[model samples]
Target: MATTTNDTTYTESELEAEKTAGSRSALAMARRGAFYLSLGLAAAMTVLFLPDLLALLVMGWTAEAGAELGIHRLHVMGIAAVVGAFLLGLFVQAYKPRERIASMWGAFLVILTASVGTVWFGVGRPEEVLPFLAVTGIALVAHPAGRRLLRRGNSYSPALLGLVAVAAIPILAFAATQLSMSSSTVDPHALDGHYVMMTALLIAPIAYGLFAALGFDGWRLASWFAALPIAYYGLLSIAFPAQVGSTGAMWGVAAICWAIAFVAVAEYSRTETSSMLRREVGHSS
Candidate 1:
């Protein structure tokens, strides 16, 4: 009778331990979900602000907003960029960060700094000071939430979801741009420059999706290529500032795409590279 009682007790203890471990894992996953969601929110906001609706409202396809409005638009993009970066930091730092994550941060910081800085300097206004502060404050809140998600393991579901989002936006953007361009009259002379940039934006996401989903070294290289469209499109707005601004009020949407692509690709690259290296090492061992 004592032996049977001890056996039952052992069984219960093992079950209890398993339950505790499961609960901990569930909590970790929940935290990771929240962290990724925050990043998605930041990306969405940046997309909304990209086209400079107010500037487009008054400026009307001039590719440049009137002086005051232009500065205001630039301020919005700057704020979006900061928020995007902060959210990205939270996501990247959440996983088991390593050399790859460091590289990811370095690359993104440089890109965001250079790109967003231009907008900050190019069209900055004193009136936007308060707004910038407010946006920064929001990002500060998101930072901690993301930090809480940090864990020692990795999960592909989050990466997969983020990648899906990264791919879907551009695909939609491509359709929207095409539709807009079809109905709107772009100057014949300017068509050449516009087509080149738009074509890249159209093709990039498809390529990003293809290689990212295919997995392997291809996945590791996805972000580097994913960045191509954003880098291409973002600059075109500045380069042909007159052109994008003139096209429509939706220019800000492209900027949002830029932010999403940047972070998505950076994170994807880091994770994929780490996974590949570990596999390679395991095989070699």
Candidate 2:
């Protein structure tokens, strides 16, 4: 009886170990899938949208378009900035799938919401929306599943929390502005310039802030966010005063954004260097 019982116990242990190993293998596969999907989507979006930015750049330089066209160019640039921020998040999620699982969520939500909104509103071709919907849906499932398998703890730094708080100002203001614009019965699609501005005002801060809060890199997005307003609203306003008028309030907000960007970059660099040094030390030891 005792010998029989020992044999059964050994068999059960072996089965349990194999089950755990198989689960880990599955999670690894899911994580890789999430990474490739996120990156491929980013590349696809860039390919899709790069033409718009390039066309605007060519027109601005070759034609020497006046204030009317100049403002339009700024609008295109703002839209590019927002897209760039989303791409950055995707890149982070791709490179560090485990560490930035939340980033994958952010990227997935952005694409899914945009896709659904476009389809529902008849603003985009139904066929065109299918790819985005399919990719994000797969990621939404894979990323969270993989993250659950890893079961990592969340840590929030004080500085990054502060950054989120600062970013909320613009985000909230942008939301209110969007509501006001909608109330006025203005056609959002017809005015690309205003659409891009409001979109940037809402998207950049929220996306980057979420990234920072989740312990992913925030500096790149922060720099992009700050650069748009500073370059388009502050500096370009001087060159094309009639088209992009300089307002005291705009400049003030731009300055604040610049400060936030600088701090984020500095903090990220410091932490990254420290981590690299620690890895080297561990390897040496």
Candidate 3:
């Protein structure tokens, strides 16, 4: 009778432990899901507003409001709030590497410098449009840094890394070309060709990189998210042919698409890794 009683106790204890483990696993999965969702939302927002953001930056060159107030205090404040919230969400979802954060900050600083340069040199020092060159230069430098931080300790996936590098190069090059030409005396029609060329250059590589990262699931989600910007740019190109002639709008659209694609791929890869870890845990148990 005592042995039977002891057996009963052992069974109950094991059941309790299993239940606790299951609960913890559920919570962890939930957290990961939330993180992916947050990332997706942030990327989507970036895509939706990117055209306007670029427009604002370009207009900052000519608009009195941009020159005097700097990106309109309200827009700047809004972007800040959005970026803060996105970063906070990402932090809550995962323990990101310090290098990844550094890379992100580096990119932000470069972009900010370019925006400020647009306003400062708009009228007074058109030659200073050269400062805008830093945007792509910084991004090119930061991409490797970010990849290094992200891939640290993990077995290197050469194909994936290569894809990312390939996608980024065109973007950086296009941005540099645009910056260089912005200072020249090119006609609007010619400038439009530059914009179209840059956009065309980015589309295939960025899509491929995202596919490698996310696999089919990620590609599907990212593709749906990517469509919005493509449509927006299509309309903008058609409606305001003269105003949207610059490469600025095209680059902005491509950046938005790539950003969303990258985030989607990252989330999918993270989830796959987590799943593998969980399987290892289960096998050990």
Candidate 4:
């Protein structure tokens, strides 16, 4: 027979181990929650917006037939591209929630930024803003949000930084032009949606690239998320030169070039790092 001298007794290491296990369990659930939430949101957004994309594809830009309709279609396509890029990131996060935590955070940033922009501008209906706010809250509860932002070992490639700088020029120019517009310049009816699109255009690339550059494992994947939306703007401008003007077309071309360069740099860096790691492992053996 054995009896404990104290009613309860536990070593410090045992307590630490138990606490660690609990933390891991919570993180695991959070990751799973992030995955499911991302997937669900992706599916819903796709269903909601895919029709608009398909309509654009099927009807063609010429179908709009009027200045208002044509401009509205452009706005729709711009918004659609942003949403599509966002959904793509969510799908990526859902694929491997643990490994792709950066993308998960990127998803949260998109929603949060959009929510704030819409609310601040008084652009969308209460229903729209509320849903995004709720989603931002739910996403925040998943994992330790923004913990990676505090990591000290994060590194940025000079080449990638250069690309970001170049890309930002046109982005800043476009932002300035949009912001300078008044009710007299742009149709008051379209102002809200236009501002909302501008927010996405301005925020998505910076947000995704910032997180990806902050020591994320899948910088190559993140490059696509950052580059593609900007590429959309370029493509739109080029395809509708009559609408966007010669200067806009030039900017669009520059954007496309930047996207290509950014992806190439990311891919080259990833390949070089992998090759170096294999060489080190081989030498060690």
Which candidate should be chosen as best, given TM-score against the real structure?
A: 4
- In angstroms, the error of model 4 at 167 is 1.9
User: For model 1, how does the per-residue alpha-carbon lDDT over 168-249 read when each residue is reduced to its tens digit?
Assistant: 6755665455434422244431232232223323444443434333332224434444454444345435544553322323
Model 3 ranges off by over 4 Å? 1-104, 112-160, 184-242, 245-260, 273-285
Q: How close is candidate 1 to the true structure, as a TM-score?
A: 0.31
What TM-score does prediction 3 earn? 0.32
lDDT of 3 by residue, 202-280 (tens): 3333433433332322232333333333333333334333443223455546555655554454445555654322123
Off by over 4 Å in 4: 1-31, 34-42, 45-50, 53-68, 144-155, 180-186, 244-247, 273-285
Q: Residue 59 of candidate 2: its Cα lDDT?
A: 57
Judged by lDDT relative to the true structure, which candidate is superior, 3 or 4?
4
Relative to the true structure, how large is the alpha-carbon lDDT of every model? 0.40, 0.48, 0.39, 0.60
Q: What TM-score fits each model?
A: 0.31, 0.62, 0.32, 0.74
**Residue 213 in candidate 3, Cα distance off native in Å:** 9.6
Off by over 4 Å in 2: 1-13, 54-71, 101-137, 148-155, 182-197, 214-249, 252-285
For candidate 4, the per-residue lDDT at 277 reads 19
Clash counts per candidate, in order, are 8, 0, 0, 0
- lDDT tens per residue, model 2, 1-285: 122344554466677787899998897787666757656874686678465554543454344554446555544444444444445555665554555554554555455544544443444344544575576666556663453523323343344545556656855665455434433234643233344243443455455445444344333343343334333333343434444223345654564565456455535744664432112212322
